[model samples]
Target chain A: MIFLSTLPGVRAVKNLRVLFMGEMQRLQRYHIIAASLVVAVIWIGVLHFTDVDDVTSIFPLLLFLDATSMSITLIGVSMFFEREEHTLKALFVSPITKGEYMISKIIGNIVSNLQTLVILYLYAWFFKEINLNIFLLVFYVIVISVFHSMIGFLLAYRSKSFTELLTGVLKYMFIFLIPVVLEQVGVITGDLLTNLMYALPTKAALLLLNSTTNGVETWEVLYGIAYLIGLSLLLSVVIRKGFEEFVAKESGI
Target chain B: MFKVENLHFTYPKNKEETIKGIDFEIREGEVFGLLGPSGVGKSTTQKILIKILQDFEGSITYKGKNLKDYGRDFYEEIGVGFEIPVHFSKLTAMENLQFFMKLYKNHEEPDELLKKLGLYEDRNKKVGEFSKGMKVRMNFVKALLNKPKMLFLDEPTAGLDPKNARIIKNLIREYRDQGGTVILTTHLMNDVEELCDRVAFMADGKIVEINSPKNLKLQHGDRKVEVEYEMGEKLESQMFSLDDLKEDEEFFRVVKNHRIITMHSKETTLDDIFIDITGGESSEES
Candidate 1:
């Protein structure tokens, strides 16, 4: 044990892997993965009745929703469940760091969300003959998933219960979806509004997802990638800080 | 093994300090129990020692190094069992234990612990399906999974039946006999009396009294003995000062000439001392 403690970097990586695997197992055991798949099938079923041309337009929106909005909502629900069970207190006493705990949640949510995105893409390909940049799609999915998972942590931290978290998620969606809806309908246009929209993580995610399906200008694609990455990093730091405070308060410390 | 001096803590929203300046020590291989009433900063003090609550105004040395100087490695040698069971309800008991066990370098077989706690039959069942007592037992298993050097338990057997509670208390004693230190916090006076080598009573965030159970009992008890004897067809009782019982003619007469039914020293109970020292706030029982 003394020798192992001396090798902290190795121990940290090992603990992180264990934590991540545990989170993934919890996601599966709770039927969250099956629920995500069911949601994908439902969306694809709904689109199957629409015209093929309409499918092309709706496909990016569905993928973006799964990557960002749905990921955040699912992560929030998972966090509240853990809090209700008082498992967070158990985690705090383990050898793993708080940063590892936060990252494992982010990584776990991304993996689960990515699985849903793949199913959606397969459905789109079978019916609509969709062809796109798979690498970029996956990259944006990870970035957007981490970004939204951080938001989910913040929501869960402030909420007193799962019911309160639901209300907070609704409020968050209403505010964040406005810019995305305006951009999608061409109601907000030009470099100024688009540049301003980049400030919102949801809008930035939508821009990146659109770049994968529909053609995007090189500069816009670069800007979307940089904006989401930078915002996700900032949110990660803020969420870690807030998480420590929330845990201290919730644990009655 | 641990030395805490002048410890003080104030919650951010509170107007006054919750843990007023206090000092105590936990010797190695001994069960040191912290007893106090509700909201008297017992849990807060435990949290600080466990490193869950930082930014405190004091110094705590664990194994000769300052506690603050330790990092995540500090938890590697310590195990904490909370008052309430903390487990993933959706997962099976074994799964929960396995997941936690992997976080530490040292590992103990969960099956052995579950069997000892009578939980092996239901090890494959989800924790959410377990009874409250069963969940509490699982919490004990979780705490011991790492083969911890020092164990911190809060109400370790609050909801167990006599048999189960005895099993846990015996395990605690065995742990101590094997050179492992323990910090126990509970409202169960029986546990303190049976397990603790020394106890500290806290009232209003200060150590009002600290001593061994036997020592405290002796200190608080009246120096008298109660003697009951059968005299011809009647049972009578007499009280005698214990200090001069050897020279008391009445006590000798009753013991020599009459049928002595019962003779007992009136030792003060830990419960009595606790209530008296903590201002008679009834200990909360679950």
Candidate 2:
């Protein structure tokens, strides 16, 4: 970790994380957090209407925190607010490098986004028979939320405004939100989709957490954890470097 | 305090050059004005000097050293007040000031500056609620918090009321009085004439006219006196060349006999001299 930070540009990554968290405190907003919690509670309540095993169905609510909440709601909305307010120019004049700024967003956003998952987990504790390990559940939520956030960050960075980023995310059913649907339906449970799911950082996190709680071997969970870290780190670097061409000189207002 | 020589800059996409070889020098404790119209590259010039926009083609030497030699540590030496308001609107005025103050080495009392700018009463209020004039005032306080030796002000008086403008200009003068140098950029003739010890008029990305405002006007001004007087209950006006009037008897007698209602010389304004020197209009577009 010291070696990574000592490298030419990675030192800024930590400060960027700190600043990003600060920005999230100001931008993620209290209303949105409250609203997301309400949605998750309502999602769990919907399980009471059906005769489904409520414990198994309630896990969908936790997965939704990573799958739907951070992707469309938190990271996507942050870009929208920044576009509306137009503080990006001010950021340019300061000594805070773009790399540092992005890292800050990642750290701040990833943590705050976990609030919904925490709320859902506690909500399930009081309402349903949640058989999952507490520590593994939180670690799963954090890692999975961060992965979805980066995907959202990449899209949000490309989007000019909140409306545009939102509409862009909404307009695509097959490309953007497919992963969310594929996880919920009982039909897409074939080997190809399962392999595809394993390749995804969020799915890998969710699968690893479920398997560990189900008394899976230590080696399998660590293997899933390794894959999750490798995928997210690789995508993060690629996104940061590729966006450099357009980050400073955004095309439209 | 600063020097820019033969600086050439063109934006990445544009074919036309924005800044064309501007040369100037600023000494300590003096207010140097970079007066020009919009798209004349005044801001670009400042950016290059302050190291905001790198990759320019020219030599910028500060305190006898290349600007490129210094790193982020150099930002501690100066305070830059952008022409537009640049504050974290979510925070209070003091919060914004305090955050930026930590980034610099030399710091000043934030509350004292707030009082100086008449912003102490509203120091804890959120910046988003501030009016345009109040925000500009807050912006000035942010710049001065570092006790910078060299200050860069671009359109510093924008959106400020006359009283607020006067306060800001006075603060600038006081900053100079304390041995600090300032680079003021504006199209406001009044600000240039009042605050600048020396003014440079830029055109076509190059400085076409440079001198003290008084000297520029004097050099291009008509050396004639326009006198208005009341004679036989009728007001009369006449212009006399200062050189010819000294030898003309009637001109001398008219001034010596009648009480002068108003007497003033015909002097060109800084703007007028600028148009004459640059051979075109010099309207500011900020």
Candidate 3:
């Protein structure tokens, strides 16, 4: 019978751990983790038949897509499901802060997404002999996952249903990922387009992933890290500030 | 204990205020019912008290400290049961309860609660598969999982069968007897009469009436007694002023000489009072 008021920080941390574990368990029970693994396996199967040179060029893009876009979509889908079931209202009354709840969701989603990325990376390493900078890949995974999770939260907050959320994700992909797609297909080139695209978080994430998998430029790596870190920090602040407002509405207050 | 003074609130999107300068105090270890019609700010007031809808205009003191001063720790001492079921549909009842139980600093054995509510056998079943009554019972179990000092129940027994509703009502009384306070908001007058120590009727964002159920009934009831008697192969009734019942010869004669079928004081019910005090226009869904 510990009094939560006596040690607020300790209580919050404990509740955060509980919430994170519960979220992860839900992910597993819903077979979301298995589905993600299947998607990774599908990617591996497709890449197994491709040319080695093509695999080198395409693998990083596929990994980046899984880390950022797929993570964002999965988070959005999970939130919409929770909203539909009214499960979040239970969380709203619990002895946990909005910050704690948001962090738990982000961390839980990141953990599951990272598992998929690891499986895909291992398969590529053993079969395709593709070696990437593990440190850079992990860094990009964390930064990109967090940034896109926040974006997912914002989208889910505005959406009223899963179909609407899917529409929002599609719109987000078209608007934000266009520059990255054009760059990947060799349709866009030069320092001007690259510098312009670096302003977008997606492009910055791709730059980091590309630098890790292909070859690296010192300045590009430095700029990509700095840009992604700054963007993630900004998104974190915005999401933390807006979380209460979003939850209040979602709770039917 | 909770004390609220001059509380005022207006939704940002609405031009008019929702809760306007309301005042009330809930004593420790008492069941306080806040009753009103729909759109009369009952839910808004509850939200403000629960710290969900902030930016209110007045002061609320819980345990002698301003509610605004409290953080997430405020929830540690209180349990809130929403009017609607709020469990994860895909998860079993036991899983949902276990997850929520871990979020609390103090946890209760949920199995006992589920058993008390007649849901023990279905604890491992997903909530989505449950009937509406079962879901309502699960919601109550979730609210009490933390062993809270105070409980805020919104329609706690709505959609429940009489037997299950009786179980919930008894549990609430047991909680109160064990020194827990409760703030209940519901339109079910029978529950209010059976459980509340005091009730406030809110309308147009103001508490128009506040008193114990017995006191309210006395204040509004007719001060007379009605007697029904079988006379000459027909049933007849008569009303006598309660103030002079002993002295009134006719009343005495009827009681002594007539074959009295039934007799009762003409007292108003809490339901009638609720309708009268709240203008009976808006539905009682709030």
Candidate 4:
């Protein structure tokens, strides 16, 4: 184990694990996990009362809503708690890099989203007729969660308060998320609008989640996968660069 | 352990430099105090030293290497105790300490530290439920948990009772005795006087004076002694130059012939020196 630490990349991984565990512990202790479970229960309520017997079609929709919107909101909530408590200052001075901090938070949010996935999937499997591939759903949920988590970081960096963060999330939902969601529910329809939805990360996220249940065009699936992954990587770079400024702001520079 | 030379820095939005060409050295295994009033750049200097605000136009070397050259690993060798409480309120004290402790390759035992700080019984209590003083003590423990070679403490005893403050000061002294370096920043001149081996007084974005506390007192103090003697119902006081004490027979005559109420050299206090050198209020919390 000591020799492994002497190799490159091992120490960061070790620190990442420590930070990830801390994140999870905070999520539980801060009642963030309980809050997430409560939201899961709400989604289960929506599933139980739906008219359809075979709820495979709506499973991805609920998961998509959870993974995308909840991912962003939950990450924002956790970060705002850290900010309010000034724990971020403590973490800043620790022997961990910003990348590790960011990735640990993203991974922690993924776990919360996955927990919701499991609860919802199990409910669908036992109580209703479902025909989706669970493994593919897990994979899609992870991707969607990661992309939105990065968006959470961006909004968090620019927000001055929890209220401000919620405002930013609302603006994002109106601009990126609500449009795609409206189109998915057949509220808006046009080739131009449909093509424009392809340009948003949220659209790619919903596409990836929807592909799990029904057969999507192969190119669309590839586009959705490539788009979200590519956008997440781009957002990661932007976040990493912006983190120094954020740290300076948080440090009261 | 650290040398800062001609350091100058301005916030991106500000027109004036916050740290204007300040120079100082923090000796290894010694407590160095950075004393100043509000907005005079003591914290800015510390932030620079700790690698928090790095966009500065000067040179700082940690252990003879450029501070810029050091990466995140630099934090492995140091710990910071913030002036404000910075712990997860919902988490237990032990949990907070353990989380931070695991980030370092080397660490002191948190249980022993909590016990020393009178916090062992409350280790499992959530930090949100802790008293303000308890939280302050917990910050000190978190700073020491990593067994860091250098400690950067900002108002470590700001919100503690005398007994708890004494515990923290003694632990700081013990840490120094055990070959740890400390950079202390506080408006509490008493803490500075008790713990600092050397102190720098800052004002207007510059280090105006830097020396040992004793030397500063001696330099800024009177070279005379005062004698207050009781003569019947009235108190008569006289001053004598300390340099000519051996040659002055009148001082001895008063000492022998009168009832002495008080007699002492007029060495100044750190609070007075802080005021004189920094041109700021004496020992007022910032």
Better candidate by TM-score, 3 or 4? 4
Error of 3 at B15 (Å): 3.0
Q: How accurate locally is residue B45 in candidate 3, as Cα lDDT from 0 to 100?
A: 90
> Candidate 4: deviation at residue B164, Å?
1.2
C-alpha lDDT of all candidate models, in order: 0.86, 0.70, 0.85, 0.89
Q: Between candidates 1 and 2, which one is better according to lDDT?
A: 1
Which pairs of residues collide in model 2? A16-A100, A16-A103, A16-A104, A17-A103, A17-A104, A20-A104, A20-A105, A21-A108
lDDT tens digits by residue: candidate 3, A1-253? 3555358677767877888998888888777778888888888877887767335667678777788777788788788878877888778878788888888888987897778778877777777777667777887788788888888888888787888898998888887887688888888899888678877888878888888767768888888788878877887788766777777766632
Candidate of highest DockQ: 4
Candidate 4 per-residue lDDT, tens place, B2-100, comes to 999999999998999999999899999999988888879877788888898989998999999999999878888988998788999999999899899
Write down the TM-score of every candidate. 0.95, 0.83, 0.95, 0.96
Which of the numbered candidates is closest to the native, going by highest lDDT?
4
Q: What is the lDDT of residue B275 in candidate 4?
A: 74
Task: Name model 1 segments beyond 4 Å from true.
Answer: A1-6, A186-198, B282-286
lDDT of 1 by residue, A1-20 (tens): 67765697877788779999
Ten residues in sequence with the least summed lDDT for candidate 1 chain B: B277-286
The chain A TM-scores for the candidates, taken one by one, are 0.90, 0.75, 0.90, 0.96
Please state the interface RMSD for every predicted structure, separated by commas. Answer: 1.6, 4.8, 1.6, 1.7
Pick the winner on DockQ between candidates 2 and 4. 4
- Candidate 4, residue B12: Cα displacement in angstroms equals 2.4
Ranking by TM-score: 4, 3, 1, 2
Cα lDDT over the full model 4: 0.89
Query: Across residues A129-166, which tens digit of lDDT does each residue of candidate 2 receive?
Result: 56676676667666666666677777777787666777
Off by over 4 Å in 4: B282-286
